[model samples]
Target: MTKGGDEQLVGSSSADTAASSTSDVGLVDETKSKGNTTNSTTDPEVDQPEVKKGEVPRGPGPFFYIGGANGAGLVSVYCRSKGWQRIHDNKREDYKLKWCETKSRETYYNFKEGEQLLYQIPNNKVLTTKIGLLSSLREYERVMNKISTNLNPKHVEIPDPKVAAVMNPLVWVKASEKFSQRILKMEDFFPESFRLDIKDEKEAFFELYKDTQIWICKPTCSNQGRGIFLLKNQAAVKSLQARLQSIEEDPVYKKLPYKAPQARVVQRYIQKPLLLEGKKFDVRSYFLIACTVPYVLFFGHGYVRLTCTRYDATSDDLTAHLTNQYMQKKNPLYSQLKEETVWRMERFNSYVNDKFRQAKGLPKDWVFTVFTKRMQQIMMQCFLAVKSKLECKRGYFDLIGCDFLVDENFKVWLLEMNANPALHTNCAVLQDVIPTVVNETLDLVLEIFNKSLKGQRIVPLQTLCHFVLLHNGGA
Candidate 1:
């Protein structure tokens, strides 16, 4: 074992130093007899020094805890709690190193003595894993490639609709639509009343008329209540088309803030929405899958997000259509709007449990029995569809946020699925949901690592050390 001149072995036995050369450091079989002190017996011809029993031996490879800054820190806490040793820290910089090797390898030098850090792990190669915005459809492929390449240290990416569509081409819903349909089968899912007119001479409207009074105009790729307009009159349809065309033509619209150039799908609108205190709202039930196995374990608890304003199809009030935190804060209808009032998944579940229990004639298990059961089925379908298409398994997704609407009939219609579900604990519901989210995330990561390691030998120390430094702080 080569050590820097200034390096000192702390908390290590004398045997550790002598056995370091054996390449299995700090791992001794306790069942071995205590009388056998040295690794090597006296051989007069060779004149080799005897390996002492109390010495530390070098391990096969380095151990790392890799993730984003917050994730890395969380794992660090977890590892420390478990009393696991041989840990190193790094960040995305290490991953960049894997991609870009020609760039000069950085050398750390002490200004006064011209020496590197004494205790720095040496000859350890890095395995870098980056976690960031899966910004576009193209980035999805890039992220998946990185994940596949580094199989040891897993990557966690949060993908939006476009990326999710690229990974698994599924139908999405506009916020305005009461019922968002998942493409169970390309043929059967399309309504019998609807027809696809690819080359219709009249580009006046792509119409889905359930009845004369109700119509929904949905742009295929828009999200967060954007690019949707109800057609009350013929003029409204024309006006919407003109507006959409103008948006498509704008340079800025071609980039961020707009997902134009993508075709928009229009459907029939649901005029009647069940009101809570005369306010129209939707619940954002966050679903998570540890692994995309045939049988999946879902983290049930999620939050309900309420729109501050009452339902009005004609009104372009931000709060009316969007259940987003950003839009909700701006809406004046919510009497007590504070950052902390935001709820998490668990809190929302508890609230629902209590609220339904207190209601005059509601069933005893209204939320768990009816609401959550329906939500689970919808999510299971979505996950099954996604898993059937994608190759990789063992991912943590904020699966479908099933936004539902209860009509006068009290029938629930599935709304849009939010692939990249936001976990904000500003509300009590969100705050309570964080623990389950964290635990489920960790569980998935461990399961992936364990599965990958099953038929494989311990990774080389150099590689492991590199991953640790890169993942922890060396990035």
Candidate 2:
């Protein structure tokens, strides 16, 4: 398949259009009713009744609404396969499922909790934005540390000797492990980060800064490697600090939100990243919050995004440093070398096996085993970090795109999480991957939603395809 143009993220301003592949299906326009139905009390096609009290009656139905064109093709195909009719109007609240690219306040305000399947959980920025993630992680760390201190052996109860004889003596150890399992050590997977907007955090970064160190500065709310640059010298860091300080002091800038720069975070750059065939790359994986009621989560494999040119630490071009598809597309050789820019997980696993298996003392299938588990653990840690803070409802679900970096030492580091990941079938690998991810996402969502509506248990999900179960908060 020839690589077409890339698609926009969830909150992007791109115009929404019906999937060209689904041209045969009728996607009823919201602005104009199908002829003669404008004055009718109910639409005969969907059989939806007139609104009462701003809510539709609760029940499973065969109507879906896709708010954008990014992944609309696969979503439409999936809905069509299930004989579900598509709802074209974004304002229509009667749809059984609404997959909106951008999260809107109106959607949540009008949400019929248990009756509708909404795509994103409200207030998910707690884990998605750079500053939000950093804050949540720090706050979570503080809470967990306090709890762990209380759970120390010194505070443990002294068991009866006679009763302890038959029971496992490692009760406290098990308890501690159980608590720790929910959140991994941030240092183990996440790079050190500091928020530039906060004064103390900014000073702390400068205090810890070294002449030889490198830091990658990024915008808090942006994606696709936009406004990301490396700080290799003290001058670069100071310039950034001065610029931000000026902005903070500018009353006019503060009042004009549209002109103000977004908040930012500077992360210690992974200087020794492992390269594939001399090109820098990063793994793009899925962290799906499939169900929020009791929280059913999954981890799905995503293809690797590799830089077009050979990686060079001294290179000033961002295309050499940033491995995102958007960054790579800027290179002149992108169209010719496009095929080498993306690799399926299996290809990555095989390459690692052949190249670094013996040399690095890695396992035969290290990519699928150790590396995968590391990613899962990191993702779980991030989820648990903001689990309590996230706004949850029965109908809400989320699919976050998680970026990971593998160092030369085989250490996995979580870079950042994106709310609305791109689902463009731009290349051969995306064509093979994106559709499956969306389909399985819908499959599991429908299964859980339908089962929950019928008072059925949420476990033993029969529709879980390639997605691996991370956490099942039960029915």
Candidate 3:
């Protein structure tokens, strides 16, 4: 998995294929086809897409997982599983690249003047602490997107997350109710989306995309699919709001809100997600921004999690609508769901082609190509949102696990952005991929931090992971 022996961290989320792992089934490539292309007609397999190269200063040191609560421990296990050593005693670590939040000490600490803790620690402890969690990306996306326009002359906007989030049923509905009267003009090439609310989102089902019936509502900042639910109409929607209000007002029900106590991100359900046998499934793509300063991104092959039960939006089954591993494990079908529930993109690709080769209404060939493009666009947008503002004072990088779903039309929809996606391997499938991914990401982080260090091996490195440079940290 090492990038040759050079270990040079060249800036890239858009990489020139240093290496690729093909044996792992279900793991798909995250490369973007460069030519003028649209969702409807792009050849995802366009060989030798335009690749660019640029050099950035790199730093050295071993990397480890931080934020132990949100899959950090799992990452640590994976790293150790791969023969990487863990820093048992924090005192001896030096020039060592460690990622920590406010809760850390000399390693990563609370920011206080005397103790050098709390708020101040994140300045160096973590990359840059956000008043908002990754889950709150909804409100802060503009801050991230603002980076591209402000820093780059090309003004190459990463449009997926920008489009996906803004077009969310909750966002547009609230906007139209508050700002519909005023018109916001657009450029010719910008993506198109309908400005609709919860009511409209639901009505779109019976009146527009008749195949869709229920709407999915989620708390803006949550994990393990805890606050997610399905809405049938105004009554259900009202009940949800009432429940939130009750939690907010009740003493036992509330502690503190991650973002807004009652806030939620809602969208119409994709009534027709492709089912694996009897179960409904969704894909999880991991996008690694090895270094934000130089704006390096990696769209690696990812794992997929599926529901335990057969697909049934009408059944009011939460497991069916939500396919995250955390949510799926709770169902009675969990035992049988193990091998069937999770998959690698490599296996997924094989299955899709073998099973759905001639299946009608499936945009089968373009799934990987389209899915990859969407993931890249979203990833770029995320970095753009925070690139300029991200205080990478000492090599602070983030690996985001983004979720997506493909409607029966094969039009992929960016579902939710998890600030802290879990890293638990409840099944055998994840053991093969997740740890390797963590190892690869750690390598990239080290490369970016030590790219300019003396006596480092620098070569045209080759590995399965492709590095894509979105914005230069030095720029």
Q: Give, for candidate 2, the lowest lDDT window spanning 10 residues.
A: 30-39
TM-score result, candidate 1:
0.49
Instruction: Please report, in order, the local distance difference test score of every candidate based on alpha carbons.
Output: 0.36, 0.76, 0.47
TM-score of each: 0.49, 0.83, 0.59
**Rank order (by lDDT, best first):** 2, 3, 1
| lDDT value, residue 411 of candidate 3 | 56
Of 1 and 2, the candidate ahead on lDDT is: 2
* lDDT (Cα, tens digit) per residue for candidate 1, span 1-475: 1222112111110010111122222223211111111222121112123222344323432233222121222333443344433222222122110110001113111111111011111111010000000011123335444544443222324357676556421222232122323223221212111111222411434342322454555433334454455567766666755776687578886676423343444544556765554556556554443223222334345555667665686675656765666556667755475432344435544654565446535555565666666656654444433332332222211222335555433445555444323433344454455445544554443443344335332222221210111111101
Model 2 lDDT tens row, 1-475: 1111112111222111122223213433211111111111221122233323335434455778766555755676777677677756567788888876655557767889888898866567677778777777887889998887666666656568776566553776778778877666789888999988778999999888887998999877766676799999899888987898799889998798457776778999998899999989999999998888778899999999999989888788999999877777789998899878999999999999999999999988999999999889889888888787777788788888889999999889998887767776667787789888988998898788778778788889898879999988883
Which residues of candidate 3, in runs, are more than 4 Å off? 1-95, 99-213, 244-262, 355-365, 453-459, 462-475
Model 2, runs deviating above 4 Å: 1-61, 155-170, 177-182, 254-259
Tell me the lDDT of model 3 at 365: 53
Candidate number with greatest TM-score:
2
lDDT of 3 by residue, 1-475 (tens): 0011111111112110112112111322222111111111221122231111122213342433232223334444544454444443323333233433212334432211211111111221111111122222333444434532344424334468966555545544554444322221111111222222234533443344322346666543344566667777667756765665565677654554322253444555677877777677878877666653344557765777788778886887787778866566678887675678888787777777777667753456555765677666655554443443444433555666667676565556566444333444445676667656666767666665565233343332343364444444343
Q: What is the lDDT of residue 261 in candidate 2?
A: 76
Per-residue lDDT of 69 in model 2: 50
- Whose lDDT is higher: candidate 2's or candidate 3's? 2
